[model samples]
Target chain A: MEWFIAKIFAKYNYWISIILMMIGFYGIVAKDNLIKKIIGLNIFQTAIFLYFISLGAVKAGTAPIVDAEIIRKGYVYANPLPHVLILTAIVVSVATTAVALSLVIRMHQEYGTIEESEIIEKSRDKGMTWT
Target chain B: MIVSIDLILLFFVVVIAIAAITLRDLLSAVILLGAYSFLMALIWVELQSVDVGFTEAAVGAGATTAFLVATISRTVRWEKK
Candidate 1:
């Protein structure tokens, strides 16, 4: 039973990551509100982060730090490269979110509504008609 | 090692993602999205990506939530639905 449970858990983690990514994608594509779109974008980006971090896991691996005792025993440790890459990715995601939010705010001020359909309608009425 | 905890975490992530996107209320969606991020962070920690987990907790669960709430305050809470 224990082995079965472990196998199930390991398999389910990957599935969960995939489902989160898809849901985030759906939100980004289907949501009408500008802010909700941003939320979805965040979700999508976070799902990728989760995926990458999960990929870095190594069972029974120690921290990447080198200790004298572990060196003597010649034991391997988990790689820290992925962790460093993810730190950079997180910063990039935050910067992107900030810029997107700023644009949304500007759009709201100009159109007075953040709904994508309403914005399109208003633009059409104004003879912009770029939809 | 029983992996049921990981499965439960995955389940929570899925449920929160669904709630985040399907809700008519924008605030609710934002909150659920934050919850989703937090669960993802927990998964990262379980996977032994402490640095990534820290960043996810900080930016995903923290700043993103703040930004969404602030944006919602400046706009309507729900759509026509």
Candidate 2:
């Protein structure tokens, strides 16, 4: 029991992120609504961001801002590389969400309903096969 | 401790995530998703990624939510069961 607890404490951040990732995966796979799916995608993306940020964490570390005093003492800083990468990721995520919402809007305009099953049914009536 | 706080925030994030998906009302779900994004921004800041956190707060909490709400207004409000 002690070993198990120790392991959990040592790596609980990863465990939590894994749980979140699984939840988002379930949402993307099981949910029928497109909006829910988009939200799920966001959750998944955030979880990934969480995991990346956690990977960059350091014990007794400060932010990556530079200073002469800190340089003299060899102060450790949190990884700034992940921060930069995740900035790009955030922009991409927003762009993707916008495009997805616009697509959803277009689908609603075409079909008059946003439900996946209803859209599939309507498409079938129009002699379109599931692709 | 920071670890405990992180765990607690993670718990809330998970709960909000589940609620965002399971909620019957689409508007409520979108709002909840925005809240989730804000909480995530907090976590990123706590992790010392303030730049990422700022972007998340701006894009995730602000732009994404607005886009979702606009889409909701243009589309159906309630999810069909």
Candidate 3:
């Protein structure tokens, strides 16, 4: 029972992250505005980042800082690989957001509105084939 | 991170995300996204990823907000009903 409390119950980050991910997914799928959809995508990505970072935590472990004393003490270092990967992923996410927002800007300039449904309707009205 | 702090941060992040999606003004939503990114950075630092938190704070909150503002300025602010 104590082990359960110490292990499973201590790892609560995963469940909340799942909920957050769903909210982002909902935004991407259901929102009418392109910006809102993009916001949702950001939210979803953040949630994934949270989950991945959480997975890197070690029980009774310290941060992955290399110190001679700590090494002699044999302290367990939390996995640093996920942290590095997520760092790169965050940058990529920002780059992706920039590109996606620029596309929205173009869509707005052409269609005069950023709503997904309206853009589709306007494109069809203009006789442009949008697959 | 303290469990209580972690819970509070997570709760606020979730609330802000919901607000960001539901808000009508694109500018306000963009601002909320900046706030969201800042909170996410704090969460990362708490998770022992200080480097990731720094990138998120600088790029996610900073550059992303700038790009969003530019896009909004060049396009529109309010979502049409």
Candidate 4:
């Protein structure tokens, strides 16, 4: 039963991460709203984070902290580098989200709506082409 | 080893993602996207990356969702088909 649980946990983790990523990408591509696109972007980035964190796991490993006693006993420790990188990634994600939301707000004020299709339609009508 | 639980979780994640994309309501899509993130975080936790899992929970499930919802509230909530 324990072995079954472990396998289930590991496989589930991988599949969940992948599905979230694909969905996020689909949202970004298929959604017409700028805000919704940003949300999808966040979801995509988060799936990557989950994948990396999962890769860092070590079975039966303890925290990376150097406990004097544990060191003397020579116990295995989990990798800490991924954790550190993830912290940085988290900060970057927050900053990106902020910038994206701000851009959405600006788009709303200028275009009067946040729908990508509507904005494109209006711009096309204006004959002001911008790639 | 029964990998069934993970398969179930994976199935749910896929369903949520599909729902998020297929829904006409932008608000519902955003909410489902948030649910997707939360599920991803749980996967991270199961993999034993406590720190990464915590970060996902905070930034993905919390901050990102809030940002999306706030932006939606300030703009239109539906896309015309």
Task: Order the numbered candidates by lDDT, best leading.
Answer: 2, 3, 1, 4
What is candidate 4's CA lDDT for residue A98? 91
Q: Across residues A35-100, which tens digit of lDDT does each residue of candidate 3 receive?
A: 888889999999999999999977567778889999998888778999989988998998899889
Between the candidate structures 1 and 4, which one is better when assessed by TM-score?
1
Error of 3 at A12 (Å): 1.7
Off by over 4 Å in 4: A1-19, A69-75, B1-8
- Total backbone collisions, model 2: 0
Better of 3 and 4 by DockQ: 3
Q: On residues B1-81, what C-alpha lDDT tens digit does candidate 1 reach at each position?
A: 126677788778777778777788888888887888788788777777777777888887899889878877876788655
lDDT by residue for model 3 (B1-81), tens: 567888999899989988998899999999999999999999888877788888999999999999889889998899877
TM-score of 2: 0.95
lDDT scores in order: 0.79, 0.89, 0.89, 0.76
For candidate 3, what is the DockQ? 0.73
- Residue range B1-81, candidate 2, lDDT tens digits: 277778788889989998998998999999999999999999988887888888899999999999999999999889877
Please give, as one word, the docking class of candidate 3. medium
Instruction: Give a tens-digit lDDT track for model 2, residues A1-131.
Output: 99999988798778778888988898889888899889989999888988888989887778788899998999888989988988999999999999999999999999998888888999999999863
Write model 1 residue lDDT over A38-118, tens digit each, in one string.
777877887777677667767666667789999899877767887888889888988898899888888889999888999
Per-residue CA lDDT of model 4 for B1-81, tens digit only, reads 124554666677778867776777888988887787788667656555667767777887788778888888887788677
Docking class of 4: acceptable
Instruction: Give the Å error, residue A86, model 2.
Output: 1.0
Worst 10 residues of 4 chain A by lDDT: A8-17
Ranking by TM-score: 2, 3, 1, 4
